[model samples]
Target chain A: MSDFTRDEIHRLALLARLEFTDEQADAFAQQLTQILHYVETLNGLDTTGVEPTSHALALHSVMRDDEPRPSLSNAEALANAPEQEAGCFRVPPIIQEL
Target chain B: MTDAPAYATLKELQRSLEAGECSSRELTQALLDRIEALDGKLGAFLRVTPDEALQQADAADAARRQGRRSPLLGIPLGLKDILCTRGVATTCASRILRDFIPPYDATAVARLRQAGAVFLGKLNMDEFAMGSSCEFSAWQPTRNPWDPTRIPGGSSGGSAAAVAAGFCPATLGTDTGGSIRQPAALCGVVGLKPTYGRVSRYGLIAFASSLDQIGPFARTVEDCALLLNAIAAQDPLDSTSAPVATSDYTECLGREIRGLRVGLPREYFIDGMEPAVEAAVRRAVADLAAQGAEIVEISLPHTEYAVAVYYICATAEASSNLARYDGAHYGYRAAGTRNIIEMYSRSRTEGFGEEVKRRIMLGTYVLSAGFYDAYYSKALKVRTLITRDFAEAFRQVDVIATPTTPGVAFRIGEKLDDPLQMYLSDIFTISANLAGIPGLSLPCGFTAEGLPIGLQLLAPAFEEARLLQVAHAYEQSHDWWRRRPELA
Candidate 1:
C-alpha cells in the first residue's frame, strides 16, 4: 500500500487550495491512509476487455441545433450581480500592488 | 376544519385538493405554519417564500376548480437551494451565492410548478453539495428530526429532515455521490436517486455533471414514486436527460415480490460495519425472503473502489464546472483585488467551504497536466469496472440489497474532527452514483438505541419503476414509516 506522507498530504491540501493547520494536516494524513486502504481493494478486480462506461445510460451526440433561442436577457442576468457597471459584472482588479 | 394535515403523502394531499376538501392556499399555509413551528430547530429551509407559495397555491386551486388536475397539483414541497429558483434565493448553502437570486428557474423547478406543485421554499444543503453531513452548510446544520443532537445526513440533509419533520410532503435533492441516499437512510425517509439522466439538471448548480442527479425525498416509497412521476421526463433543456420512455412508478405498488431474486453483495458486508446495522439489513432481507422473494448472495468485488473513484471523478468535474464561479459572473466577489485572476482566486477562497476547497484542489491536482492520466483517467476506468460489477450481479438477481449506511446516524461533531471518517458515511451509497444506477433507501428497522436504520435496493439504470415497486412492496409489508421522530 502506498503511504500518504505529510508532504503528500500537504501537496493535496495545497492543490485543494485549503489553508490547513499543521495539526489538521497530520490528522488528515492518518484519515486519508485509512480511506486509501479501503479503496485499494479495487486493485483485485480484473477489468480485462471490459468497456469503460462513462454514463449509466448510453447517449449519442447529445447536442442541440445551433439555433439562437430566447434566453435570459443581459439585464436579467446581471440584475443579481452584487456589483455591476456598464452592463458587465464588476469586480476589483486581480493584480495585487503589494 | 380539522387540524394540520400532518403525515399526509403528496398523492393524498393532491386528492384532497382535487376533491375540494382543501385548497392549495390552505395546504401552503399549513406547510408554512409547520415550518414556522419546527424550522427553529430543524433549520431545513434556507428561504421561506410564503407569499409566493400562497400565490402559486391559489392559482393551483383555481386550476383544479377548472378541472385541471395533475398528480402533484397543490402539493407543497421544498426545492433544494442548489436548484435555481427564478427571483428566489438559491444560495446553495454557501457564502459565495448567499445573496444571489437566480433570474431563471431550473428545468426541474419549472416543471414542478407546471405540475401544480407548490414550492414551500428552498431547503439548506452542504455548501456546494460537497459535505457528507449537513454540517458544511454556511447556514446552521439541519438537525435530524429523530434526534436533534445528531446530523441530518447530507448534502441533501435539509430535504431529508424537512420531510422527516413533516414540514413538507416531499422535497427535491440532488445526489452526486451518496447525498440523497445517505441522508435519507440516516433520516428514516424514502430517498431515491434515479438513474442518471432520469431527471433534467439544466438549472441545478453543477457539482459533478455526470454524477449529479436530482430526485425526491419523501416519507414513503409511494410518495417518492409520485414525485418522480412529476419530475422525471425527457427535458429538452437538459441535453443529458434520457430520451427513454417514462413509466408511472406507482403502477407496480403492492405487486407480489414472491420468487423475485434479491442479491446481497458480499463485498458490502465487510468489516467495520456496525453489527446492529448488519443485523437490521439481514432482518429485512429475511422478511423479504419469507415473503417468497429469493435471496441470493452475490459479489460486487469492485465496490470497494467507489469512494476513491468518486472523489477523483466528481472533484475533477467540479473543478471544471466551478471554474466559472469567478466574480465576473454572479456570486461573491472579493474587494481590493488588482486583476481578474486575483479576483477569481480570492472570491473562490472566500466563497467555498473547507471540504469544497479540498475537493476542488484534489480535482485540480488530478486534472492538472501531469496527473490527469494517473488519477482521473484511472478513476474513470475503475468507475467502469464498478458499473460492470453491478451489471454482472444484476444478471444473477433482480435487485441488489444492502444496508443503506454502514451505521445509524452519528452525533453531530462526532466525525467533524476527522474528515475521512465523515467521508466514510457515504461509503455504502457511493457505488450507486458511480454506476449511475437507480438506488432507493427506506426505513427498514431501528437500532437498539432506537435510531432508524435503512435498507438500500439498487437496480440497473432506468429501472426506477421496478426499484420503486420493490420499495413500495416492502413498505407495505412493514410499518417502519408509521413511526415518527419524537420532537416537540
Candidate 2:
C-alpha cells in the first residue's frame, strides 16, 4: 500500500513554490500516488554497501584562474526580463504593511 | 521545392555542393519552401528564419567559391528549441519562457555555425523535455511524418519529424532518457546520443542536468556521423565537457564488423513487447549475424529498476535547476500579485503545464527532510548497480542491440492520461543515459502497417566509433534507410 495522501501532495506543492487549484491538486495527488506505487519496485533490490554514483565522470571541482573576462552586458542580461527598472529586474514587494 | 535534389543523405548533399551542381542558396530556399508547404500539418518547426538562413547560405557559397571544402559546410539544419540561439526565441516549448530570447548561441550551436551549417529555425519539444509524447508541448504536438494520427516520440519529436518530413537534411536533438532515440525510431530516421560529455551543453536549457546530452537526427548513419563530427568538441564554457579529443566519425563508416560480438540482453527481449517490433529487431540481428558478426546473450540484471532510478534522479535535478524561474528573472510573471511569494507561486502555476508541475512536486517530496535518504540516496546507490550491470555486459560484447521502443508509435492521445505508462516508453533507452554510454537508433524494419521499427546499438563509454561502425554496417546491408514517408 502507498503512503501518499492529499495532505502530503499539498505540502509538496508548497515546498515547490507552486500554486494549484483544488481540482488540479486532486488529480495530481491520484496520479502521483500511482507513480509512486510503480517506483516502489526499486525498494525490492538489495543494494547494501554500494557507493552512490552522482555523476558519470569522476572529475572533481574544476576551477579556472581568477581573472575577469567578457560576459553579457547589463542590457543583454536583462533583455528578456518581464519587468525591469533602473537596470534591475522588478518583482512584487517581499514585505507587507500591517 | 522542385529544384531541391532528392538525395537522402547529408554526404550526397555535401558532394553536390562541392561539385557546384546547385548553390547553397538554392538548396536552402527549396527547403524553406518545403517547410512552408508541409509543416502546417506536421507541426515540426515552431519558427522559421528565411532571412538568416539565406544570409548564411550565401556566405557558405562564397566560402566554397574560395575552394574550401568541409563536410558540413553549406548544409541547412534545424535546431531543437532547447538550444539557445542568439536573437532567436529559444523556448523549450514552454509558456513560461515563450518570450525568452537568448543572448548567445549554445556551444554546440556555435560549433555548427563555425563549421558553416546553416540554421533553419528553432524546433518544438515536450515542455522542458519532460514528456515521452510531444503532446505536452505548449505549441501544437508534432505528428509523426509516417502517420499524421500518431505521435513522433518526444521531447525531441520536432527534431525527428522535421528530418523525416524532409524539411531539412538533418537536425540537432537532446536526449536525457530516449528523447532522441525513441523519436527517431517512431519517425523512421537515424538518431545518435553520444557519451555523456561527448558534446558540450553550455547553452542547452536545463531539464535534468546530469542526464541531458546533445545529439543529432538524420536520414542515414553517415549523416549522423557527419553532424556529430562538427558538434562534438570540448569547450571551457561547459565544465562537464569531456576533455577527450574529437575524431572524424565519418571515417569509420565502412569498417568491417565480421569479427564483432553483439550482445542481446535477456531482460530487454521479455514479454509485453509488440510482436512485430521484436520480429523486426530479431531479423536485423540475424542479418548482421549472417554477415559473420557473433551474437551473445547477456544480462543487464538491474534493467527493471531503470525507470524508478531515472525519475528520481531526473526530477531531483530538474527541481533544483528550475528553482531559478521565480518570476523575478526572465520569463513569465503573474500579474496582480500582492506579494513576492504569491507572484512566484502563481506565475509558475499558470506558466508550467501539468506534466512539469507533477515532476516538480514529485521531486520536492523525494528531497524533503525526512525522505531524502529513503528516496534520493537509495536511488543513487541503485544507479551505481545499474551502471555496473552495463560495465559487466560490455566485457563480453562489442555492442548491445535492442528494440528502441516496446512497440510502434502509439496514437497521439493514447498514453496522455497515464504518466507511468508514458515513462515506460523509454524503458529500453534509459539505461544508456544512466550508465553514460553512447547509443544509436536507426530503422531496421517496419510493421505491416508501414510504421517503422528501430534497432538500438549501444557501446561502452567513449566508444562511439565502434557503435557507429556496427550501425553503418547494418544500415548498408538493409534497404530501410532508403525509404521515406510519403508526405503529401
Candidate 3:
C-alpha cells in the first residue's frame, strides 16, 4: 500500500466525523500510517476462499416473540438530549437556515 | 462488627450475613468508610453511592429478616463505568459521556440488582474501553493497589484495583480486547471473560460489539463464578445472547483437574515477554500438571495476527458504534456551531481523547471506498483463521494456559507516547476475544518488585463451568492471591 497522503488524512478525518487542526492532522497522519502498517501484517497469510466469520457463534438472526413490553417513556428517551424541544431532540437546521 | 469483614470474600460475607454475625448495613457502612478513607489515594471509584448502598443494604436486611436467602443479597460490588446504571452517571471515562445517565440499568446491572447486590458505585476505565492502560481515562489514573506509583492496567484497571484494595469483593468489567484480564493480572486479582454471548449486552456502552463480553474481577475464582452466575442469561433484549445450556457456575467449583488436558501455546512465551513473568506462569501450569492434569504443547499459528486483526476489526466497529455521539441526542456537544455538520465533527473533536480520535480516523480510512476490501474485509477472513486455530487447539486440550500480559504492571505514563507499544500489552489476551471464548486471569505469583503476575486460561465457548473448575483447582494450590495490597 502507498503511504497515506495529508489529503487522504483530511478525507479520513471528515469521513470519521472528526475535525483536526493542522498539527493534529499531521500527527494523526503519521500515527495512523504506522498503525495501518502494523495491521497490514494480516496480509501475510493467504486466506483463499475462506469464509469470513462475522460473529464467533453461528448466530442465526434471533427474533423474540411479538410481544408488547415496557419501553422507555418519551420523556425518559429525551432525558439526556444535549438540546431538547417539546418532547424531541433539537438539532441545528439544515439547508443553510434555522 | 469488626472492620475485617471489609476484606472478606463474597462467600465468607454471605455466610457471615446468614449466620447473623453482622447486619448488611454494618457491612456496607464499613466498606463505605474504607472506600472513603482509601479510594482518594487509589482513584478506583468514579462515583460512590453511600446513601443508595445503605438503603439497599437495609432492604436486604429486611428481606433476610423475612427469610429470603439469595446468595448475592446485600453483597456490595462495583461496576466498570461503561455499563449503564439507572439514574446513575455512566461515563465510559470520556468527556463525551461525562454527564450521560441511563434511564434504565444494563441487563447485567439489573440482574445483579435483582440478586439483591448492593451498588457501591461505578469504577474507572479507559475511555470507551479503547486503551490498554487506565491512563486513557479522561479522569485521573487508577494506581496499582500493590504499588500505588505503578499502573493497575486497563481499561478495567479501576475495577481490578478496587477489588485488590479490598474496597469491594468483586466488580464487573468488560473485555473486548483483554481489558478485564490484563488489569486483573496487574492488580493481583481473579478476572474472568465469558464467551461473547454468554452475558447479555443490552446496556454495555459498545466499543466493539463482536468482541466485548462482561465479566467479573474478584479476589478469588469462586467469586468470579458467583458474579457470572448472576449475570449470565439469555436476554430477549440482546439478540446475540445465546440460548445455550446454563450451569450454576458456582456449583462447578472444587472439581478435580485430574486427567484434564491443558495446552500451552508456544507463541505466547515469545522473547519480548518478561522472563520472570513467563516463569511464574510456567510454575502455575506445572502446579496444574502436578495435580494430575496432562500438559501438551499446542500451536495456534494465527496468534501473531491477532493484534493486527483486532485493531482493524475493533476500530472499524468502534467507528460505526460511536457515530451516535454526534452532539444531537446526548452527551457533549460543541457549542455555537452555525451548522449541523460543524456540530457533529467539532463535538467529537473536542469531546474525545487522543487515542479514540486516532482509532476513529484509522477506522474511517480502512472502511473508505478504496481501502475497505484491503483492510476490513481481509481482517474478517483472517479472523476466521484465528478462530479456527482455537477450534483445532481445543480438539486436543480442555483449556489453554498463558501469561495474561507479557509483563507485570508498569509505572504510569510509561507507554503513553508510544501507542504501538501500548497496544502490544494485550498481545496474549486479545486472541481469546477474537475467537470469542472464555478467558480467566489469576494471580500466579509476584515479581521481585512484588508486583503481581497473571496466569491466563482459555476454554471453549459455554465451557465456563470447566474454566472455573480448572481455575479453582489451580487457585486451591497457591496462596499468591491471599496477599492484599497495603494501602495505608
lDDT digits (tens) for residues B1-488 of candidate 3: 34597679999999999999989999999999999988999999999999899999999999999999899999989999999999999989999998998998999999999999999999999899988879999988999999988999999999999999999999999999999999999999999999999999999999989999999999999999999999999998899999996789988788789999999999998988898898999999999999999999999999999999999999999999999889998999999998899999999999999999988887777788978989999999999999999999999999999999999999988999889999999999999998999999999999998899999999998899999999999998988878987777
Name the lDDT value of residue A84 in candidate 2. Answer: 94
CAPRI-style class, candidate 1 = acceptable
DockQ of each: 0.46, 0.85, 0.85
Q: For every model in order, what is the iRMS?
A: 2.8, 0.8, 0.9
- Model 2 residue pairs with clashes: none
Overall lDDT per candidate, in order of appearance: 0.85, 0.91, 0.91
Encode model 1's per-residue lDDT on B370-431: one tens digit a residue: 76766677777898888878889989999999999998888999988676678778889999
Clashing residue pairs in all predictions, respectively, total 9, 0, 0
Q: After superposition, how far is residue B71 of candidate 3 from its true place, in Å?
A: 0.3
* Model 3 chain A: lowest-lDDT 10 consecutive positions: A89-98
Looking at model 3, the pairs that clash are none
Better of 1 and 3 by TM-score: 3
Shares of reference contacts reproduced by the candidates, in order, are 0.53, 0.81, 0.89
